[model samples]
Target: MAVRELDDLDRAIVYALQENARKTSTSTIAERMDVAPSTVRTRIQALEADGVLTGYHAEIDYERTGLQLHTLLVCTAPVPEREELAERAQEVRGVVAVREVMTGQENVHIEAIGRDGDDLSRIGRELDEIGLTIEDEDLIRNEYETPYDGFNVASE
Candidate 1:
């Protein structure tokens, strides 16, 4: 389908949905906008078709699920070694997420979850060996208050 620009109503719908996907159902959105539910449904389907609404999934608390450790590793990668650094991070036992960043000097950012401090230290050391200067480390105590992204963007 062709990509069309979002109109005022479209932006409003998207904004409402971004705040709470479930709250803005076809009927609710129609009622709020004084339009027909089918119209709302059609627009929503079109939005999904256009890839604006990718998907949805539940958010679970990792700590409650025995995943208490959260560590952010901001490492600087030397020239032409990002792929190798990614591989090394993947080999780490409890690295949940590793992403190549676009920061001017920083090469990649790693978000890892280990069982204990020892695991974190192990990961830190691994990065050091790879010549990646570990810039910062922080514990993620609670990540529930982030802005609500109506669509699903999650790991497995």
Candidate 2:
């Protein structure tokens, strides 16, 4: 499908949905943006069809759930081993995210969540056993996120 250019109204709709996709209704967005409810719905449908509006998901707090440690593991492997190493890291118990990074000293990055330092160390060992050399580790203290801030450009 050809990409659709989103107008100002469409931008407003996206911003509203980003704030709260499940609770925010089409009518509420229409009232806020001063457009018809059908217009908001139609635009949302088009956005989804165009792959702009992806799946809605809830962001869970791991600390609240008792899995408190959030660590980023950076490792380097032989070019042939990068894919396999990343796949193996994903199977690790505490791993939350894994990515093959191209531009950096490290070739692979893994985000793992654990109950504590021991759990994190166990996860690191699991990856190390797969031939991933641990180059660096960073513990995430906190994260502040605001979704779709760029899509709210209509207000600017």
Candidate 3:
């Protein structure tokens, strides 16, 4: 599909939603933007119809939910097999997220999960046998947490 243009208000609306998806309402946003609620609704519909507003979900706080380790299982694999590896990696225990990124000199990236050192090591070993080279590892610190909710349309 061709890329459509976004106006200032549209951008503002997207920004507001991205910040707090659960809190804002069209009426409330209209009030802040000094526009009518119907206008707010109209713009929102346009955004959604254009496939901009994908969806929403309640982002869970893993640390508070008994999730122990959150680490990436970076893999160096051929570009053609990225999707297959991602699908397989998802079934591994404790993985929070996965992506196919431009990993410097590598082609794909896989995020693995573990609650402790053993889990990380075990996953690494399994991945290595499958040609998934572990590039780097780190602890899942809350300091770098993002709610992962697609977007927010809450008030300013």
TM-score winner among the candidates?
2
Worst 10 residues of 2 by lDDT: 146-155
Q: Residue 147 of candidate 1: its Cα lDDT? A: 39
Q: lDDT at 138 for candidate 2?
A: 97
> For model 2, how does the per-residue alpha-carbon lDDT over 1-156 read when each residue is reduced to its tens digit?
667788888788788888888899999888878889998999989888889888887877888998878888999877777888888889999998899987445899998999988998898888889888889999888866676776785558
- As for TM-score, the candidate ahead, 1 or 3, is 3
Task: List model 1 lDDT by residue over 11-108, tens digit each.
Answer: 65676677677656878767767888899888888888899778765666767777778878888886588768877877767777788876646777
For model 2, state the Cα shift of residue 110 in Å: 2.2
Candidates' lDDT values, in order? 0.74, 0.85, 0.68
Ranking by TM-score: 2, 3, 1
Error of 2 at 128 (Å): 3.0
- Kindly report which residue stretches of model 3 are placed more than 4 angstroms away from their true locations once superposed: 121-131, 143-156
The candidate with the higher TM-score, 1 or 2, is: 2
Ranking by lDDT: 2, 1, 3
Q: Kindly report which residue stretches of model 1 are placed more than 4 angstroms away from their true locations once superposed.
A: 1-4, 78-100, 121-133, 144-156
User: By lDDT, who's the top model here?
Assistant: 2
What is candidate 1's local distance difference test score? 0.74
